[model samples]
Target: MALGGCANAWAAASSASLPFDDIAGSFAKNEIVELVEEGVVNGTGNRKFEPKKNVTRAEFVAMADRLLKLAPVDADMPSFADVPAKSWYYGWIEAAVQLGIAEGKSKSSFEPSARITRQEAAVLIVRALKVDPGSDTGSGLDYKDKSQIAPWAAPYVQAAHTLGLMGGADGKFRPVDAMTREETAAVLDRILHDNVWSKAIRQTPNMGLQLGWQNGLTTAQFKEQVKNSAVNTLVPRWFFLEYGSTPVSNHADPSLSSWAKQNNKKVWAMLGNHSDSALTHQILSDGHARAAVIQKLAGYAKTYGLSGINVDFENVNPEDRLSLTAFISEFGTSLRAAGAVLSIDVSPDLGTDWTEAFDYEALGRYADYVVLMGYDEHWDGDPVAGSVSSLPWVQSALNRMLSVVPAKKTILALPFYTRDWTLQSGGASSEELTLIQQGYRIRSVAYNRSWDSDLGQYVVSYMRQGSQHKIWVEDGRSLGLKTMMAAKRGVAGYAYWYVGAETDEIWTSLSNAIRYASY
Candidate 1:
C-alpha cells in the first residue's frame, strides 16, 4: 500500500494512497489527515513524520497562529536576526511575538530554525488559546523529566496537560526535548475537536507525493525493487522534448503502466529538456510552441494511463522565470482537467542561473508539487568537499522553500548516492559512489570515523598518497537524520533521486528511519 492520504490529494502519495505516504498506520493518522485537510497543519512532504524529527519554533508558531485565528497585532514581521521578512513563518512569528505567545531566543535573534521544546510548545499553545494557566496543582505533574522543565513554562505545561492539549508518554515528559510534527498536530486537533477550546475558538487554517525516479529500468527490475522499498509513486524518465521543434523521443512502455495499476503504483512520466537552457527558453518564450508541447505531453499522460507528468527542466536562464511559470500554468491546467497532475523539479535558490530560472512560488501554484532536488550542496566542481546534502544544508534549503511553496505542495528529493572527494593540489576531485560502494569504502579502509554534530553526518578521514582524504559520508545514519529534519519541518513526501543505487541494507535502515516511526 502507498502511504495514507486524503482523497482530494492528486499527483502521488504514500501507503494506500494516504495524503502522506509515511503516516498510514500512525497513532495520529486520522488526526494528521484531518488537520492537513482542514488546513490547520501539514504533512512532512515526505513519507514518514517521526518523533526523531522535532518541530521547529516557526512550525509550532504557524500552527498556533492558524488555530487561534491570529492576525499580526504588529504588522511588521519581527526584526529577529534569523527571521527574514520573506520567510513563510515570519508573519506567524510576528503574531506570536505580538500576542506574547512566544519570545525570541535572544534580544536580536529568534532562532526561528531551532526546534521548539515540549515546555515551549505548551506555553505557546496555552497562551494562544488564551486559556488561563489554571492554578498548578502540585500533584498534576509527575513526569520523569519534571525537573528539566523551564521554570517560566512550568505552569503552562501543567495547565496544558490538565486541559488535555498535551500529554506525556511512558510517564516521561522529556520537558526540554523538541515537539514532533505529529505531536503538534495532535495538540492542534485537540484544541479544535476534543476540547472546550473548539467551542470557544471558531477559526480555520489553510494548507505526499512520495515519488521515486526510474532511470531506464525495465518493468521487471523496477518491480523487484518496489517490493523492498516504500516508494509508492514511480517517476520514469520516459520522454524528452526539444521545445517540440523535433519529434519527442517516445520511450513509453505499456507494461510498466500495466504493472503500476496491478500493484497500486503511480507512474509520473518525465519530460526533460536535455539540460539545454536555450531549448527550454525557446518553448517557454513562445506561446504557440509552449501550448503545443503541453498538449503533446498531457495527451501522452492520458494515453498511457499514467498518474502525472514530472517536469525536469534544468539549466534554465534566469530571464525565463515568467515564461517558465506560464508554461507550468498552462500545462497544469490541461493535466488537471484531464484528471492528471503535474510535478516540477527545482534546484535550491543559490542566486545562480541554474536556480534563478525557477520561481518556486509560481511553479508551486501551477504544479501539484514542486520537487526540490535536495542534493548537490557541494557539486562536482566546487572547491570544498562536503556531504552532498548535509542535514543542516538540507534544513536551510527546506526552510527557504517552505517560505514560498506551501508545505503540502512541496516534495523533497533524497539522494541515493554520495560523492567520494579525492583531495588534490589547489583543489579537489570527486567520484560518484552508490550507497553500496560508499558502504564498502567505509568498511574497507582503516579510516577514523566520527560524528559531525553540525552536519548531523559521520565524517570519515584517512591519509593516503600524502594527502588527507575527508569523506562526509551519507549512510543510513545521514539519511535517517535528513528524513527526521524533513519530518520535523512537515513536508508532503520524499523522492529518491533514482533507484538501484542503494545497498541491500539501505532499505532496512530506510524503513526503520523513514517508515515505521511513531510521532
Candidate 2:
C-alpha cells in the first residue's frame, strides 16, 4: 500500500491504544495523546509517540491532510523527482500542493524525506490559514535568532507567532532547526484552540459605542464619566461620506483616540452616509467611487492612529447589496493590512426594504464584527406605539442574524435612549430623549410607570396639551437584560447607541449583567 494509505490505515488502528508509552511524563503528553486519538498523528511503532523525534516533510504533510480533512483533488500530481508517484505520502503531498499548504524544496524535487525546519513549518501553517502578512511592519520579533530567519520566511514566522501558532524557546527561534513531533502536535493544538483567524474577533469582553455627535462632550469629560464603566471600545462619528463621492471629516478629535489608548481602550473611527440613501447608493453602485471612499477611510484610520473603522451606511438600496459587500471586503482587506478592525452597523432584519439591503452573511464574512442595531423596533415616524427594542423582538432579530453571522463576530447594539411619543390629531410624533431625560419627563408629568414583562421595559402614558403622550423607558433594568442576553448567547459584546445618552446606573447595570453572564 502507498505510504499515505498506510498512514491512514495505521491511524485507524492506532486509536485503540492512545497515550503512547514514552509520552507519559512528557510536557506534550496530553496533546500527543489527543492528536493521536484525533487521527492527525500516529506512533512510529511499538505504541510510542517518540515525542523528540524529528518530523519529516512527508510526515507533516500527512498530518496536515488529516487535520484539515483535505478533499482529494481530481488532477494529475505534479512531478517531483524525489516523491515517487506510487509512494503512500505522494497523494497527501499532492493534496497539500493543491491546497497551497506545502511547496517543493526545489523546482523538480520535494525532498519528501528531509526533516521539516521550524521556518518551513511556520510557512506551511501560515499558508494553511491563508493569513496575509502585509508589510510585516508592526512589532519587531523578540526571537534572539530573528536575524537568522530566512528573508522569505520572516513574514510567515511573524504571522505564525502573532496568531499564537508558534513561539520561541529561550528567546531564540531556531529557524533552521528540525521541528519535533511534539512541537508539531503542540502547534496544531494551538491552531485548533487559541488561534484567532482575525485580530478583530475579540476573545475578551468588548463593550463598545456609537458616540452621539450632538453630545458635544469634550474628550476629558467623556473619559472622566466612563473611566469606571465597562466601556472598552469607542466609535466616534468622525467622518461622513458626502454627496459627489467626497469623504468629509466630521469631529476629527485626536484627543479621544489618545485618551482611549491611554486607558487601554480601542477607538474605531466611524464613517457614515449621514442617512442619505441616494448618496450611499451612488457611492456603493460605482466601483471607483466605492474604492475611493474605502481608500480615504483607511488613510484616515491610519492617520488618526485609530484601532479600527465603523461603517454606518444607512438606508442603502437593495440593488447595492452585493456592491456594499464588495466595498466592505476590499475596505476590510486594507484595514486588516494596517492592523485595524472593520465593524459594520446593520439595522435589525425586520423584513424592511432598508434592512434588506444588508447581506448579513456576506458582511459578517468580511467585517470583523457586525453590529446589530437592536433598537428602532418602532421608529419616530412609525404610526404604531411600541417599545424601541423589546426583548422578544430583539431575541427574534438576534436569532435571524445568528443564522448567518457567527456569534463570536456579532455585537449587539442597544439603545441608551428612548422615544417620547406625542399623540396628536394628525399622527403620533416622537422625540428621542436620553435615559435621564426620559426619567425626568416621566417624573415631571406624574405619570404612573409600570414594568411590562412582555416588553422588558417601563411604560408610561400621560396626557399633555390635549394629546396623549407615551414613553417606553430604556433604563438600567432593560439594557441589563439585553446585555445579559447577548452575553448568554456568546456574542462578541454589546454596544450602546450613544455614549452620553446613557445614565450612570446604565453602566453599573451593564457591568453587573456582564458579570452575571460570566462570558
Candidate 3:
C-alpha cells in the first residue's frame, strides 16, 4: 500500500518508476513526476521527458486520450485530411472530434503536426472537461495578456482559467505561445489534484478497520449482530441520485449514525445511481445537476457526521467514462472539504455494463480508495458452475488493480455469499447462498468435498432432483485463508459485501487473519 501517511514511501517509489533524465530543476518537475506515477504521461525515451519540447495537435490528443480514457470512435474515411487511418493517433483524433473536444485548422485539415498554442489548449481542455463556456464571456479574464486572447475563444479561455486548468506566468496569459511538454503535464497534474483536491488529507487511511455494508436492515436488526462482530466501519446504502436536477435520499437512516457515534465505529454513507445510465449521464453532463448532487451529498455527510462516502454507481454507459471521472473528481473534492473520505466501488475490469465505465487509474486518483468488488468470477449467467469468487480470481484481479491504483488506496471487497450452482440439460443456473445457508445446506445433503489448495476454497458436490449441484463453499476457513493471502499483498484493507448474511464464527476467523497475517 503506497499511500501511507497519504504520500509515503510507496508514493516515492512510484514517482521513481519514471525517472526522467532531463526534468531536473524544471519548474514543472513535481507535476511531471506526479503524472508519471498516475500512468498518465511518459518520457520521450532513454529516460528523458524532453520537458522543453513543444506539443503538437497529435501529441496532445494522445496524452489527453490516456488521461481521460475517452471512448473509442471509428471512421470510414479519415477524420481529417492530415489524420489518416494509417496514423497511430487516428482513433484518438476521431474520438476528440466526435466527442466535441477538438477543432481542425480548416474545414478539411486537422494539421496534426502543427504546434498548439496555449489559448487553443485551453479551449480543448475546457471542452474535454465538458463544462459549458463561461456565460459572462467578457468578465472572467484578469491576465495581463487577456487582450491577446482571440475574441472567439475568450469564453473557453476564461472557463479554463476559472477552473484552474491553465494558468499564466508573471500575470501574462501567454495566449499565443505554444505549450511545452512540461507545461502540458502541469495542466494534467492540476486536473488530478485541483485546488479543492488539496483538502483531501486522508488519501488512504486506517486500512486496519474491519468494514461491511448495510442494506435493508433496521437499526435494531443491524445492532444485534454488529455488536459482537469484528466490523468497525459501517457503510449504509442510504442515499441516491434521481433524474435531472433532483436527487433523493431513498429514506436515509440517521439512527445508524447515532449507533456508530456511540459504538466507537465509523460511518460512510453509500450513494447509488439505480443502475440508470441515462440518469447518471444527466448528473455528470449537466453542470448544475452535478454540482447540486455534490453539494447535497457533502451536506449530508456533514449533517450525519459521516466519516466517508461509498459510491456504488453501477451499470453505467461506457460513453460516460470520462464524464464519470470528472464527477468523481468534483464530488470527492467536495466530500473531503466536508471532512468525509471518498471510496468508490468498482467491478473487476471486464466486459459488463457494470464494469465498462470505470477507468481505474483515474478513479484511484479521484477517490481516496478504490474498493475492488472481488467477486462474481463465475456469475449466474455463466454456462459453467464455479466458485463465486475463487481465490485465484481474487488474487489476479487485485494484482491487476494494484498496477494502476496504489495498494494503500485499494480495498478488496469480499463476498459474504456464494452460489448453489445447478448443472443440467447442458445449461447451468445458480441460487445465491448466504454463508449460514450454505453451512446448513452442506449438513442436510450427502456431499463430496475437497480443498482446492490452488483456489483456497472447499469444493463440494451433491446430486439431487436428477441434477448435479456444485457449491464452491465460502466459509470462515476459506475466507480466512483468502484474507491471509490478500494481507500479503499489503492492500489498504478488506470489506465484506453486506451485513447479516454470515455467522459469528466468520467474523472471528477474519479478525484473527487480519490481525495475525505476516504482511
Model 2, residue 76: what's the lDDT?
A: 27
lDDT per residue as tens, model 3, 137-169: 636678887889888778888888888788788
| Residue 451 C-alpha lDDT in model 1 | 59
Q: Model 1, range 59-142, lDDT digits (tens) per residue?
A: 888877666655432222124658877788866775555334677787567888898998888888887665688656424698
Candidate 1's C-alpha runs over 4 A off are 1-207, 243-247, 514-518
Tens digits of per-residue lDDT for model 2, 1-519: 699999977876665565666775567777887777667888888877888999999998888766664433222223366887678787678656633467888756899999999999998988876678776832479888888898889988999888888999999989999999999999876665654422212233444342332245677776765675567787777788887535565667888877777878788778888788888888888888878887887787887898888888888888888989999999999999888999999998878797888989999999998999999998979987778989889988998999999999998988877899988778788988887687677767856555576877667899888788888878666776777677778888777777777666456456544543442
Runs off by more than 4 Å, candidate 2: 1-215, 244-250, 424-426
Candidate 3 wrong stretches, greater than 4 Å: 1-207, 351-353
lDDT of all predictions: 0.76, 0.77, 0.79
In order, what is each prediction's RMSD in angstroms?
16.9, 23.6, 23.0
Worst 10 residues of 1 by lDDT: 70-79
> Which lDDT value does model 1 have at 481?
66
TM-score of 3: 0.59
lDDT measured at residue 463 in model 1 versus the true structure, 0 to 100? 77
Positional deviation of 295 in candidate 1, in angstroms? Answer: 1.2
How far in Å is the alpha carbon of 516 misplaced in model 3?
A: 2.9
TM-score of each: 0.61, 0.58, 0.59
